[model samples]
Target chain A: MPTQPTDQGPLTSQFAGDADMLELLDMFVSELGARSEQMRDLLASRRMDDLRTVAHQLKGAAGGYGYPMLSQAAGVLESQLAAPVRDLGEVAHAVAELQSICDRAIRGHRPAA
Target chain B: MSQGTSTHVRIDAANLESTRPLVLAIDDSPDVVRLLQVRLKSEAVEFASASSGLEGIELARRLRPAVILLDIEMPGTDGFEILRMLKESPDTVQTPVIMLSGLSSAHDKVTAFDLGAADYVTKPFDIAELRVRVRAAIRTFTLFQMLAQRAQIDGLTGLWNRSHFDRRLVEEVSRHARHASPLALAMLDVDRFKHVNDSFGHPAGDAVLAGVGSLLRKIVRDSDVPCRYGGEEFALLMPDTTPEDAAAVCERVRQMLEQVTWPRHPEHNVTISIGIAGAAKATQLAPEAWVERADRNLYAAKSGGRNRVVWTSIESPLQLNRAG
Candidate 1:
């Protein structure tokens, strides 16, 4: 399990004080909630293909939404999923790491008001 | 990373229409599109978005925007495929594309570059940096358009220059020959142009040339191509025109020149000798030969009188006059 970063300041600043940034941050949080749930369900069911699809989407989207850590985690998990032989333990670990990053980023960027 | 940030700030989606050159963003993520809209708005760049590669391709074809920001990952027709399509299309080939992807790997970057991306920007792009890149792309595109315009236009008369005229003549001649359609070539020379320069000064001579150039542009049909063939000489390539029709147009030009109110030589008048050749009379000959035929008639016009049109007769090879 990756340690959760205590400070949300860096993530919040990514919005750059723009209303469109806030909207994107809100969208990111909403999408993260849905995708994190889907990821957990897919991981628990051992559906590597579906789980990789979710990871790939996050890999492309997270960084654009100002969540680089989540993008990195998702990218790693996606690559691991692509391996011909995947270790269940490693795949589960990568999924958990991605989930943690998503949680932190969503919490940090979501609108305060 | 969300610390020391102000809350409640807003970034509206940039307006679709503006004086700025358009910057199209093709990304599956709505969030990225919004992000781009906000960041690029500072540069006064207009925004257009597409959610898929196929949609992007269609939008690109229609808009022909100044630049494209393309995402590498999409449901269908992915970024590389879209890039290939854009590069292949004649209309969109000149548009600069900046690849937006989360894949920061050297291989991915190299692949995008190889596929004709103008620049590859990794995800979580810096707004300031993106703005700079977009401006640079616009600058490059503008420079290319200006250079292309310069190449096809005459510097002095704003008419099609000799080279462009030749190219158009070749194209029109080939088409006319292939279709057996009517086409005519007219050659005109200012009478006593050297005397005009010697008497009044080069500026007056230039004014006369410019006046005639503008007049040719104004009087000719839309299908006619008027070009400054060389100093004191002008050529008109008229497609879908008969020998009689071409002579009429040339005669109008000759009369217009005689009536032009010269600023430098108000008391003096300018005159032009014109020669015309119809495609029906010279269909079997090459384009150059056809032009030479017009030149021969031009010589006849000059020799017969300095202010008349001498045209080749289709029925008989004998030269005829428009105003005898």
Candidate 2:
């Protein structure tokens, strides 16, 4: 098993047995994974407009799936991308953080006892 | 993994029933559409989706859905534009619309409401709240449908009222003129109906009228519009029928009425006199004039005998004028 991120702990006890919540978490992980890769490519190409759009979408989608911290990370990237003079390095850091969140989200809430 | 997770767009032809109320979701994102499909599936409604604003408007015009869930930030024609277009078209003017958007700004909500949206729901909505809103919209739509239907029908007889009949006559006349199709009109009145009310009570009179209304409803062809024109008077507009054919139909109805054993007054039977007019091809006469001709023939039927049909063809305008 992959080492889990310190910030994203194991699956919450409340969500462990609920099938619908688990499905939603799974969907969020998958969707975030796609957006993270897209953001990385857009940053490499210095496509600030496209990167901002992806960030804006992720900001809304993450919050909807109960990942408020991930949503805020995406929102920060979105705000920076909309700046008149964008910092590629900062945007890259945000994208990497987003990818980490998605990785942790997919790893489930907790390691099996 | 992401490719595998893409939503399956299931346009299930079998799920679409003509009688079922439709709920349309118009969003560019397939995820949102899929979410709506999943959420709305359990409701007593059918769900349809469009990925673009133009397609959404076209579907709205065609399907006339009970409620529209429109996304505000679509690519080309945004939600406000689509809402304006929906209000402009007569076909969809009355359809209720609910705006959906990720933008939760008060300005956006106010603008949506100002543009005549029935409700506004932000993205990441509470599924339960949306279900309640959708159910409420359906109720409103159903109530409007029932009220409109009730307005067009007579309460006592359960037949189309005089106002609806007149409107239908105008519409039929315009359609027949455009297509040059044959059309026929018939008018009937109960013989000495006042005597029935005088001898029996008004409730008995109403029963007789209702009985005749039921008979008219049962006897007319699907293409025929049977209406209770006024007190004890009924009219039928038969499309694609000639004067001779309308006369036969009227004759059949007259016979049916004659055979009925009056529930209130079985000893004395009720009878009707009928008059028919037909445009074998097309006519330049106004709708009122056509009805006047039928009315004139009805007078003839009453004068000749209270239990027969009188008819005039549009080809014999001179004879019609003389008879009138």
Candidate 3:
């Protein structure tokens, strides 16, 4: 919570153009707020295991949803949490960056055909 | 070539080769499962997901899905272990399984392959690539199934051929033996089949044989395996059926045979003489001996009359009881 995450530019998913994924993308965007809340709660409770699971899930899901950057941020947070030499500070910062991307992700981003 | 067999062959082939293949995904993460459901949604295949290994395996066994998308890092039984178990089980052994994992390590890939995984897809995989891979797996699986069915199916009778009969007899008998389940075998001979060929011409004889095959297909239970033993001879293997129950089935077929009016040869009624032999428990007799007993009873039926059923238990006194 101490270090503020810098903006990482626009957050339109690369898969926005894909007709099959557009519906799923909408669902993912709708769920982002709740997902962010859950991650924050998990981090607050110091539930590193549950937090890593959430990150791992997001890492796998976001990329398919066309948000590769969000997926990458989650993957970084997951890796930090999995590391044996735990840096709680770096882990906290990674979580912030992932959440920051989630916040900036605009709903109904037009497909780049 | 019989008129009815081609349709039966087509039906059997269609059953084996599903038009819309079922694809199963076993992932621990709900998000991953949901993404897969959406991504793999296509007209050519049905998608089912299980958030745990146990449920996934159960679905795989029940559906016999053409292809499986298995995730490696599951909670209870990991994908590698699940793959091993699936490969070991006969029911799901032929199903193509693609391992999905976040770990891109060669060691993990090697492990998945060693455990009998058909393909490996790392996490955040390209959507188009996954779709192509799944289609490829389904094509491979359905083709394999069709080839296997063709090998075992008889061209004329629409029943399993002799080779399939030989293999299935051994397998079913052994299975029943292990389970101590009641098992029966009926050896059927088309009475005066040579006369039909000599009198009504070869085409009429072919029609008669096809009729018998059709009748067998209609009469036998779904669990029963009916096979064309050879020309004018057939065998039906009935699992979990006693001599009495098998005789009832034979009698029903006989009655149905009376109703089948030959296309060209209406005057000549095609009759089948069935000889049924069964054991209370399959463990009592060997498969060959059991078949021999059924054949003996069939011989008795042929001698007793042209269109009668003869049945005898393996443990019964040396007497062939004809049940008309």
Candidate 4:
């Protein structure tokens, strides 16, 4: 089982050594990365519908896994893409912000001894 | 796994219909149900009325409505119980349910929202706002379904595709190995496909490919899967088929191509060289190994002469006989 990042303070503190939680978190990070790439591609192709779809999925999965920050970013991104008039620049910034937040969360939540 | 747990879930956003969106209205008042039904009639939304929270839960389990509008102030089996049950049941877990209640206090709304109610609509809910929330829930569900479908299908051919084939191949290979069943694979290549493009045109080449696709579909059994492995090449996976049987099938397909006249060149005919490989003996070989064997044989046929059928097992024997 691969190790993964988790929520800080209390929610993830108890499960810091839990290998299963770590594995799940690792999978979550990987999924986030994949979704980020997908968002980039969709934006590049100017596929707003596909971008919204991918962002919505990322939002749901991130929320489900207790990554509220990641989920919120994805949600903002989804709403931007879902809107009738899409701001491509805003979408791009949101995607980059999401990637950064995911990166930080992944680094911050490493198993604390 | 739990009973009825779907290994894969498919959601189609394109098929999302705002019309007749199923809403389970859980409230003691018949007037509330009537009001919602009348207000949403033009939206083509359907309503399943539940007088009590228990009835609401039962109806939800049976009907699997797109959204549930529950009033929190019900007498027995209050909205909270139904909400808890809905969250517990995997079937209803993902379905968005909005809590409708006279308790308009901010705390009550916060609690309901925390309990997984998609949205909290107070007793004096605006009809337009409720409709908007319902549409959003349905839209979210549809998006999830479409994502699931996209995960399974090959974006290119719109056929079963390589990922699906990879998963199926593992199971099929396992079963064949266990039962000692013959599983044959044939690798097919269009004869001088590159030359065809060089001589005629790319559009002509595409036509030839389309023709080959149709021909393969016509020649193979419905159970057999023919995949466009890549450009100018196709692969046929015939489960429970012997190498010799597969060879015959390939030969028949090749003959069919020979008869079909190319439109670009009236005098020219298209042909395909096929290589067949199968596991006649019981072995725990990977599916890719079998495919590789067939691919090697395909190259052999291509080099030996195009427009021929070559079986991997026969190669060594033919060479031995020739040596003798």
TM, every model = 0.70, 0.79, 0.76, 0.42
RMSD of each: 7.6, 5.6, 9.3, 23.3
Candidate 3 Cα outliers beyond 4 Å, as residue runs: A1-5, A8-10, A15-23, A44-46, A106-113, B1-19, B166-183, B190-223, B230-232, B239-245, B248-272, B278-289, B302-307, B313-324
Candidate 2 Cα deviation (angstroms), residue B255: 1.0
Candidate 3 C-alpha lDDT tens digits along B1-324: 111111110011224345578888888766676687777766467767777777778878877888999988765677889899899999999999999888899999999998888899998888788999998898899899999999899888899999999888898789788998988899999888999999989998888888888889987899999999999999999988988899889888877887788988888788889999887765657789878989988988888876888888776645656556
User: In lDDT terms, which candidate is top?
Assistant: 3
lDDT of 3 by residue, A1-113 (tens): 56554656767887777787777777778778788878888898999887887888788778878788888999999999999987988988888788888887854365343
TM-score of chain A of each: 0.83, 0.74, 0.84, 0.71
For B218-311, candidate 2 gives per-residue lDDT tens digits of 9888999999999899999999998878888888888888888877899878889998889899887789988998999899888886788888
lDDT of 1 by residue, B222-279 (tens): 8899999999999999988988889989999999889988989999999999988885
| Higher-ranked by DockQ: 3 or 4 | 3
* Regions of model 2 farther than 4 Å from truth: A1-34, A42-113, B1-15, B177-182, B239-245, B279-286, B312-324
Q: Kindly list the per-residue Cα lDDT of model 2 for residues A40-97, writing each as its tens digit.
A: 7878888777677677666655555566667678878877777898777777877887
Provide the global lDDT of candidate 2 against the true structure. Answer: 0.79
Regarding lDDT, does 1 or 2 come out ahead? Answer: 1
Best by DockQ: 1
Q: Can you rank all candidates by TM-score, best first?
A: 2, 3, 1, 4
Candidates 2 and 3 compared by DockQ, better number: 3
lDDT tens digits by residue: candidate 1, A22-111: 756776676776788788988999988878867876776666666667777888999999999998888988887777767776666647
